[model samples]
Target chain A: MKTVKVGLGTCGISAGGEKVYKAFQDELKENPNAFVLKETGCIGMCYSEVLIEIKNGSDESVFYSEVTPDRVGEIVEKAILSDDTIEEWLAVKPDNKQNFIDNQTRIVLRNCGIIDPGSIDEYIERGGYEGAKKALTTMTSEDVIDDVIKSGLKGRGGGGFPTGVKWNFTRGAKGDKKYIICNADEGDPGAFMDRSILEGDPNAVLEGMIIAGYAIGSDAAYIYCRAEYPKAIARLRQAIAQAKKKNFLGDNIFGTNFTFNIKIKEGAGALVCGEETALIASIEGKRGMPKFRPPFPAISGLWEKPTNINNVETFANVPWIILNGGDAYAAYGTEDSKGTKVFAMAGKV
Target chain B: MSQQQSDNFKPFNVDLWKYDGQEGALIPLLQSAQDTYGYISEKAIDYISHITGIPAADIYGVVTFYAQFRTKPLGKYVVKVCNGTACHVNGAKPIGDTITDELNIDYDETSDDGKFSLLSVACIGCCSLAPVILINDETYGRLTSPKLRKILRQYKRKVKEEK
Candidate 1:
């Protein structure tokens, strides 16, 4: 059968994606189960939101942009029932937009705008948690750290600290208990990539954290997400519950002695909490204020215990790096910076 | 406290019991209290401070520190104009100016009629739809002065129709 996917990210929803989805639902009621309707995250073509993609079997797909509720009838008639592509409404058929998608590599956003974020089955079908399983069952902690170091992945949170080296510090630190934190407090203006990743493919970040916990000998982790993005939080909650049900999270993961748990701490709309120290302080229920960082979070952080914190984008890249090997990731970008980075590309552009 | 005042925030008190002993629960708890009641009232603050044992002064500090926390009761429609970099570049100020002019209220001020309140926010993360304003949870984006004026009129029409 054919499937109709609607982009329902914050950008899409703000553009009346829900109305369009509802319109399609009303239209499809006549022949129920004739075509499947699915919800997906932002495709990064947010400027042309309310994006609708019609997939005819496996080989052919048509992308329509700037869609409205009025267009749904014609779309259902032409694209779904009649199997005719809407040439004028095509996002890929347009030269500039198609070039935009053609000229870039997408590792972190591989699953975004494609799969159903709420469905763990869709995620697993696309090879989601294999990296975490591989890291836990096959690779040693030192080996995983070495592979990450070799891959040249740095903190995408603007600090540019090496991920493996940071993990090693927590690993070497003298502490009875250590913690891992995923900083989803994307407070910077004009940046919604973190929100998109959390909404689009939360499991990638979760899997990355599970691997990080195993690597750094920490069993507990927290995702410090801002409360502004309610959709992202809701999606993360769904993803975590699904992951736990499938034994992808929680105690004794992957039938190994390793145990890890992930929790979400909603931020109370403080932009300063985007900073590492301020974020840690916010998570601890104190007023989010930054102190000196001589003893970095890797040494003594989060209740004065050893802690490892990485950005949402940083963690989202981890599973890809683990599955595809560090060398494959290192091949992209400049000699100094490895892999790809997602940008907001907002403003007059 | 007056019975009516406490009754206004009865649900907050009922839900506030769960976070009694949980560490780092103050902010989330306060957030829920605000969500239950439109804004964090003085009585709500006192009740929260009494229950959490955090000083009223400290609670006020937290409430004032964060931009999202509203101390006063909101107008029926709270219009949040985005002031992010992209929105600023794309003339977010004129959009704000248009709303305030149409409503006859300044930024962060509510109308005398209590129908609308104008507020400036850092970003709503919808830069692609720059020059955006969120009236309640509904976002109106890519706005010009005329477009915004029309939106404000529609909201005013909503108020009139209700009356």
Candidate 2:
């Protein structure tokens, strides 16, 4: 059986993806057994949203770009029913938009636009929580921290700080309780990378957070997401619920002595909260104003406890680094800067 | 307040208990009030201050500090123009100008009839579709001044048809 997937990310929805999905439903209702319909997230192609994809057993998937309600009939008739290809609508055909994904390494966006974001099974099928399992079950906290340091992963939230060093400091800090914060307060104007990841592969981010919790000797975590990205928040809420049910989060995960819990703190449209200290203050119900950096969150932060904060993109890279080992990630970029960077390219050009 | 204005006030009844004594609950409480009432009124601030034990001055300060919070009531349709770098480069100013000229109101001002309010946001995260404007939740992108003018006319026609 073939499956029909629609892009339902914010960009896609803004481009009338809901209408297109409704059209597909109306067409497929007569033959309910014809194709399985599913929803996916952004493929980083905000320009050509309302994207539809057709997939068969092991064959290469096909993508149709800028698909509308009016065009749903043609796609259903030609692609799904007849099992034929349409060249003009194809987004990944030769000499077309193929280089968009081909030219880049997509570790953070690996499951985005491919797997159903709402399905935890789909995420696990893509090896989602294996990193957290490996960290909690096999490797020691210091060992996990060492692997990250060897992997040379730095914070992807534009500051370029060494992530492993930050984790080491938080782990070394003498505090009764430690906290891990996944900074999802992406306030930068052209940046939708964090939003896309949160909406697309939320499990990966959750797993990443769980691993970070284990590494930093923390039992509690918070995702400080902005209120602007409602879909991202919904997805995170759903993912957290699913993980809790499966014992991936909350109380002795993976049958280990370590217990970790995650909570979501929605930023009330404050741009300054993107700063670590400001974000900590906002989470504390105070005004989101920047403070001195000597405390630096790793030592005394977040209700005066030891805290480690990493960007959404930085946390998204954790599971991958844990499973693949640090050397595999270090193989991607220059000596100083390892792995790929996600850029929000926008403007007149 | 007039009878009509008093009648329009609906108490924010959703999850008020969740924030009763929670620290860091001030912003979320204000956000809930904003979502329910469209704008944060003085009475709402007073109620929130009373409930959360935050000073009314502090609550007012926080409300004015964030661009998302509005003290004034918004129009039925809130038109947010994107003024990000990409949108700016792609003639966002002209689009905003067209909205203001057609609506007969400047940025951050609602029409006297309360039909439309104009706001300029940093970005809507749809930079690929530059020069975008969001009316409530719907996004109109890749827009020209003429196209925006036509869109505004359609919204105006909607109000007229209702009348």
Candidate 3:
């Protein structure tokens, strides 16, 4: 029962990995009980398109590059069944060399490509909502806020504001009704890190937002996803519905006094809507233009209520910080920039 | 309602056919339409406008904003000279000048004989290989004036031979 994994990340898709995946499907249908075929996300060696990793009983995992539909049969027959590993297609032998994941840490992207995104059980199996459960059962809202402040986890969104500070501001604002927003409107020309996370692991984001709502005392949340990301929006909509059915979202989450609700707001392809102030305006059905910030969103946002806004990547990190403790999560990345940052890695580099 | 009234409106309908609604489609949409229809014309603009419900003026604004969107018919060969920051700094001006001299046409303008069209792009992101030129997406980098001239001559010869 050896596993053969294919990198089906965005870069792989653009490079024609879909055809390769279909070819694998057809080949595996011929021999159903022979081997396990799995799909994973990018390994960051985007220069090598259609990456395939094969693992057998006694042999270490090997990666094959530039794989196409034409080479699918050859790969399954020669690489999977035989002893010889193809030399020409070998991009990097990762047995001892930790080129991709050595310097990098996977907190927000922990479950990406490892589990089926559409399944809540898959997410829970990978330790998804343990943080929310821990918060509801043990810690108070103040304790969660304090831990976040200590972690120094700044927003992965471009502005780089401290996440804890934003939460504190929303907490201090005088309002009975507060709103939490996940700014998934990633409009940076080459940036798809947010989209990938939303598509690959929507639960991580939902869980993070639910925790934020608890910490900030917000009862309502809105995910401002861009209209361009149809796939991401569909996955998120489905994930939200699944979470609600599982008692992870909606009224009395985990049987606690906390009750929160989330909705999706789609932007009409406005580039400036990625900005926090403009995003807030857009979500409120106003023109997607940036307004002067004196009070900021935390004080006066989302229909003039206290609001907390964080990007998809920032929210994804929240659940991890709560579950693993702030110190463990904060130990990685640079001093000011705590935690790993996910880059789209487009252009020549 | 009457036969006389229908006949009177027929001339207006014929006048509308001259205008294609492509002028109302956004830049990307217009580019797609152009790619579909070999070239954008008055007929395309009217067709795009009729389908999209956008004014021809608005579509024209978008088409002019993007460098890739062309209003006129292109030549047999499209030579896109890189005028991006790196190429410009590394003497892309001379290459552009040489292209205009050879083709006897300015940027975005097709040659009189419809043999070639000259265009300049901001950046193809091939900065390491500065002074790059792409002839129909086949990038030729590290180009000097003489090398560019030779490449043009080779293309011209190939075109002539094919003819």
Candidate 4:
């Protein structure tokens, strides 16, 4: 099928890509035979918002900039149908120079723009659940922990805690009902990186959470997402339902005894709730406020059981690490900051 | 949910007198009224007082406290000149002066033609490229007085072309 990727990143969405996406969806419905419309998270050229990349089989892919609802028909007609490319709107020549792709690495966000967020099959096609499969079948729980440890992936949620160490601590901690939490409460000013990932490719995050649950021997997970993001929440809810339907979530996933389930909790607007301790407090239906963190969440968390809390971006990296060996994933970023960090890059980028 | 979330309160027609009775309800009531109508009108002030059971004198005093809350009708274009420490140091004063001179209106005043309104903001957090002014949501950064003039001229040209 022909592919047309639109930048549904926060910047693009703020600049009316939501309307543009709807317009394209409605337009493509009429001419379903020739085209397929897809949504991707930010490719980092935010200055040129509503960025669109169109690819047909024989022809080279082209990137279009500043796309609007009005221009959707023209882009569909010209770029998708005829060979006549619109020069005025083209941002970069995909064939001659992949300037957008070459400058930045895409480890955490590898499956972000490539996969349909709500569809599990598209995620599987892009090597999504291979990590969970490997973790389940080939690698032992200890081996999975060791791979994460060697990868040196730090939390992108401002804390910079070692993911492997946290998982190891949770594994060592004694508990009957341990839980893994994905903190999607991204309340930092000018930060929508978490929201974009959740909106674009949610299953990557879910798969990562499941892998974490498997490693720590947890049977349940909770994704603490903020209520402000109605769209992201809706997509995540749909993704969770889809995962359960495909047996990726409920009992005996992929024909193994490791059963896991995930539920979504909407956060009341609180900036401090992004703190893990505060997030647990909010999840327990208390007033959202931060408490001292000595007996951390790993020891005594969420209903007094060992809980692992990783941010949206950190969980996004998990599936990739498991699928593409830990060493391969570790070769991307600086020594101190290993692996790719997906920033919102808002305000003046 | 609090008692305020209840729908028993009338849609509008607030009394200004009862606003002074409550301590913190004044700001929220005014904010709710302002959010309903783009700018807080006299009718909204009456509505706020009627709903919150507070005095109008205290309600008006509270409106003057916050920079974001406006009493008068704002113009179509809200020209917010950044007066934060960085913006102030990097020639934001001159840009503000140019706008005041061109519009013949002081800060927080709308033009008689309803085309422009001028206000000073704390910061837009684009300090790297300081001396910025956000016309509506778009930030025009690294601004000199001459650049500000040229930008205003472009707006005027667009207005004239439309006319």
Candidate 5:
């Protein structure tokens, strides 16, 4: 069956995506059975939000641009049902964005625009929890850490620390209680990558956390996401519930003894909380001010336990690395950096 | 996590258990106070302090620290004109000036009726669509003076209809 996915990510919603999605709803009521109406997060095309994609039965999809509520009927009739082309309304094509998409190796964003973020089934079908399964059922904690080290993944949270090395510190720490934190507290002025990842591919991040938990002997994790992103939070809630129900999150995952669970803490309003110490303090329910470091988070973090912190973008790359082997991921980027890094890609670069 | 969670934020005097004794509860409590009463009211601060046990002075200090928290009541509509580099280089000054002149209010002040408040904010992270003005959560991007005026008129018309 053909489906119509609207870009309802924050940028999309800001660009009248809700109105367009509503328009589709009203229009689809007349011919509800004709198509499946779905919502997806931003495809990194903030410039062309309120974007609509129609996947025909032939597996060929067309993307429409600058869609308004008024244009709903025409798009539904011409584009979805009749399979007729609306050239002017169309936002070029995948071919047109080849330079944007093809120029970079997209490990982090591999499933961003393509999957229905609200659907765990879609994410699972797209190889969602395979990494966690691989880690929990097969690889030892040491092996997992070593594989990540070999992958050469660095913290994309602007600190650029080697992720595996950080994990190793926490894993070797003398604490019975350890925590993994997904630092979704992305408070940068113009940076929307974290929001996009959490909005677009939440399960991928969750999978990364599960693997991180397994690698560091952690059974619990916290995702300190921005409260400003209610949509991302809501989607993550749904994704976590789905993940738990599937036995991917709760005790005895994949019928193994390794148990892991994830909790979400909302960053009310603090730019400083992006720092690890501040984030740990905020999770402990205090002012999100940065504290002096020495023991560091890996040694003494959240709840004064051995805690590991990773950025949203950093965690997003873990599943791909584990699934395709560290060497496959190490194949991309320069010697300094091993995987594709995302930027909004403004200016002439 | 729920958008509905924000609805419970009325008057800043709910069960503090939801926020109290929990680590990092102060900032969210303050945020909820501002959300409940528009600006963090003195009484609301006291009530929050009473509930959270963080003390009013410390709460006030916290309220002053972050740019998002406001001490005074804002207008029904807050107009945030972006002044980030992307917006600046894309001719945001004239647009900001237009909003200032049309509303007859400087940045951070509300109009006489309290219908419209003006705020000049840092980049809202939508630099891709530079020269943006966000009225409430709705964003008008790639804006020009003409577009700003028209949207303002629409907002005015909306207020008039409600009145």
Candidate 6:
């Protein structure tokens, strides 16, 4: 039996991904066991949403793009279950369309568009929390920080702050309690990469947070994110619950002395709150306004507790860095910057 | 409490606990309150204040600070135009202007017939589809002048047909 994977991210849903999914569902109900339908997040091709890939349980796969609910029946019958592939509907036809994935190294978005984000098992099968395990079981807090520094990853959030150095500052700060925050509030209108990452791979970000918490000596952390992203928010809530049940999160995680927990604080539609100090205030239940920082979030933040804040893409890169030595990650980018940059690819690109 | 306020306040009573005592809970509470009611009513603010203990004045400051908050009721259909960098580069101002013109109201104002509301939103991250306008959940991107007019007319026609 052939299996079908539909891109159901917000972009996809907005462009009738839900209708296409429903159409497939309606068709599958009548003709069960012919095709296995699964949903994946956007693969960065927002232009061609309502995308679906049909796999014939073998090496062959055809990605049908720009698919509408009206066209679902024909695509399923002709392309998915049958031997002949529909060239017209295929987003990238053999020996025709330029393969967009070519010459692009996708680390942060490795599992994205490739797996069922709703399924944590798929994340694990693709080596999800193994970075947390490696960090917890073998590496010390200092070592983790050192390895991160060696990786040479600057923040992808446009500030370009060196992540390891920031982590080190928080780690060494003179405070009784320190907190780590994943700034998932991709408030900048153009930066959909963070939201896409969260929607596609919540565990990777969660794992990254676990590693950061262990390194920074924080017991608790919160992801300050947009509530507008209901799907991503729902997935994250589920991922957090699953992590605790699987012992990937919670006290003494991975059977180590270190303990950590993460919470999700829904950002209530404020762009200014994307700034670190403002984010802290918003999390503290105040107006999302920027503030002057003599004491940056690193020194004093989140109810006057020392907090380390990193952007979504920054933390999203953590598990990969920890799993594959920092040097391996360092090898990808220039001297000034390191690793992949996941641009949202919006507008007239 | 007024009947309208009480009706809208039901969904948030249980959910507000997750944010209890957290100073930052105010914004999310206000947001939830806004979601419950089409707009943030005076009673809604008081209802939120009663539950979360945040002052109505402070809530008003927060609501006013952010553009997302709507003190007044909205139309049945909300047309959110993207005014982010990419959209700006792609002539979003004219698109926004066209929307305001077509709707026969200014930005953030609903039509006289109460069928459509026009608003400008920050980049919704669909940059690839610049010059995009979201009508409710559906996004119409790469739009042109004629297309925009046609889309507007369709909305009007749909409302008329329903009536």
Q: List the residue pairs that clash in candidate 2.
A: A285-B24
What number of backbone clashes does candidate 1 have, counting pairs of residues 3 or more apart or in separate chains?
Answer: 0
**Full-model lDDT for every candidate:** 0.87, 0.87, 0.75, 0.76, 0.83, 0.84
In terms of TM-score, which candidate is stronger, 1 or 3?
Answer: 1
In the order shown, the candidates' DockQ scores are 0.67, 0.60, 0.05, 0.05, 0.39, 0.52
Clashing pairs in 6: A189-B123, A284-B23, A284-B24, A285-B23, A285-B24, A285-B25, A346-B127, A346-B128, A347-B127, A347-B128
lDDT of 2 by residue, A1-349 (tens): 8888999888888788889999989987887877889999887777778788899877568888999899899888888888789898987786665477778788888899999999999999989899999999999999999999998899999889899999999999999999999999887877888988998889989999999999999999999998878889999999999999999988879998889999998887778899999999888877788899888799999998999999998999999999999999999999799987777676643
lDDT of 4 by residue, A1-349 (tens): 5678877754566556778889888887898776778787665566677778787786457788889899989988887777788987888754546586667777777766666676788888888788898899888889998898888898889889999999999999998989899999886644567877887788989999999999999998989887656668888998999989989999999899989999887764565678898888767644455788778899999888899999999999998998887898789788877788886553343
lDDT of 5 by residue, B20-88 (tens): 376657776766666656777677778877876778888887777667788777888889887877778
- Alpha-carbon deviation at A149 in model 1, angstroms: 0.8
Summarize candidate 6's per-residue lDDT along A1-349 as a digit string, tens digits: 8889999887787777888999999998998877899999887778887788888877577788899999988887788777878888778868864688665799999999889898899999999899999999999999999999999988888899899999999998889899999998887767788889998889989999999999999999999887667778988998999888998888778888888999888877778888888888888777777789878888888889889999888999999999998999999988778887887666666
The better candidate by TM-score, 2 or 4, is 2
Q: Give lDDT tens digits, candidate 5, residues A143-188.
A: 8888899999999999999999999999999999999999998766
Looking at model 3 chain A, report the run of 10 residues with the lowest lDDT sum: A93-102
Q: lDDT, candidate 3, residue A235? A: 81
Across B1-163, the per-residue lDDT of candidate 2 in tens digits comes to 2222243666666475367576778888888787777788898988888887789999998888777889888888889998987889899989988988999989989887777889988766778888889998788888999999999999999988966
- Error at A16, model 2, angstroms: 2.0
TM-score per model over all chains: 0.95, 0.95, 0.68, 0.69, 0.90, 0.91
DockQ leader: 1
- Error of model 6, residue B86, in angstroms: 2.6
Error of 3 at A319 (Å): 1.0
Estimate the TM-score for candidate 1. Answer: 0.95
- For model 2 the TM-score comes to 0.95
Chain A superposition TM-score, candidate 4:
0.93
Give the lowest summed-lDDT range of ten residues in model 5 chain B. Answer: B1-10
